[model samples]
Target: MTDRRYTLSKNERLCGKKNIQELFNEGSSFYFFPFKVYYSFNKNKTEGDHCALFTVPKRLFSKAVDRNLLKRKIKEAYRLNKPQFYNIPTSRPINIAYIYTARKMLNYSDIESSMIRCQKKLADNILNAQNDEEKN
Candidate 1:
């Protein structure tokens, strides 16, 4: 059987214009090197079922092929490192957008490393926020 943990299933992809708008409107964000991460908690979603969106702006990559390649790289990185993000203790599901901010193409290894770092940082940020709220 294929390992589900490493797969990026359709349900795991954030879709629909309304959902996208809500994520950008209400989500909190952070920048880590080549990516800008935006995330929000979804109270209605099932546990451990986070959704993510990958974006490569047209302004930076005018060619559709280039944009698609970058997006694929980003998605692969996320799929591989997703289990780490799941380790973060949370009652609600998370919606995330990983917007590629780099002007040029980067090696897959570089993108993967940055993705790992971003995951760790995001986990720490979420834990800190949860702790802060609990104490207040």
Candidate 2:
């Protein structure tokens, strides 16, 4: 009913062999300036909400502190902007993983802008997917 309804939990962080495999195999993707999003619908595991996983590769961010900093920025952006996703119907749930693909660390402003762009794109994608389902 509310945006806070879709926040991710520890168990939904995209672990386990099958979930990881599905992420690689079936996920559709979108790329903003600094982030790449991979998402898929899991009929079996879905409830009335969506969940997310955020990742930053160690290869790109050599320092753990830098990685954690970026992760926090991304999380904050998500927390603030998640109402857009929650506005969608609750009958089906989605699993999304966002990978930070930037080569350099960015400030909070840049991360917030990128997150807004990502959320807009995600909303568009969901609408299109729903339209397609209605057509079929």
Candidate 3:
């Protein structure tokens, strides 16, 4: 069973208008069905692992309840799959924002699977970046 400590805390949430703007402006993103993941490596030492922000567009999800539900599901999925990414040997901390792009709310299973895929892809990306730097 996943420990309670592994659960996302307030400190693990990506915040600040300036940092968010930079992340959107400079980060690379990829779509995984209902989610669009934006990520970039942060070399600063504030956090050892990654921090995340979850977003659901108001234009797409008009109801506050619907938007909140999707947000909860997405967070749960990420919380479960985060261990793999955390275990990947890397020095730089990563910042991630998961933007919900789908018009409709997807089921939990779908969200979980997508989150898993996103984590694996993210790990691959980190590995590739490390390899590229080593090659230079």
Q: Write the candidate numbers in order of decreasing lDDT.
A: 1, 3, 2
True-structure Cα RMSD, model 2: 2.2
Regions of candidate 2 where Cα sits further than 4 Å from its true position? 3-8
lDDT at position 120, candidate 2 = 83
Give the C-alpha lDDT of model 2: 0.79
lDDT of each residue in 1-136, candidate 3, tens digit only: 2333558988789988977887899898888887888988774654565779999999998999999999999999988878777778776788899999987778999999988988898789878888888899
- In angstroms, the error of model 3 at 112 is 0.4
Predict model 3's lDDT versus the native.
Answer: 0.84
lDDT of 1 at 46: 57
Best TM-score goes to which candidate?
Answer: 1
Q: Quote the lDDT for 124 in model 2.
A: 83
CA error at residue 93 for candidate 3, angstroms: 0.5
lDDT scores for all predictions? Answer: 0.89, 0.79, 0.84
What is the Å distance of residue 38 in model 3 from its true position? Answer: 0.8
Please identify which of the two predictions, 2 or 3, would achieve the higher TM-score against the true structure: 3
Clashing residue pairs in candidate 2 are: none
- Tens digits of per-residue lDDT, candidate 1, 5-79, equal 688999899989988999999998999989999998875675657899999999999999999999999999999
Query: Candidate 1: which stretches are off by over 4 Å?
Result: 1-4, 46-48
lDDT of 1: 0.89
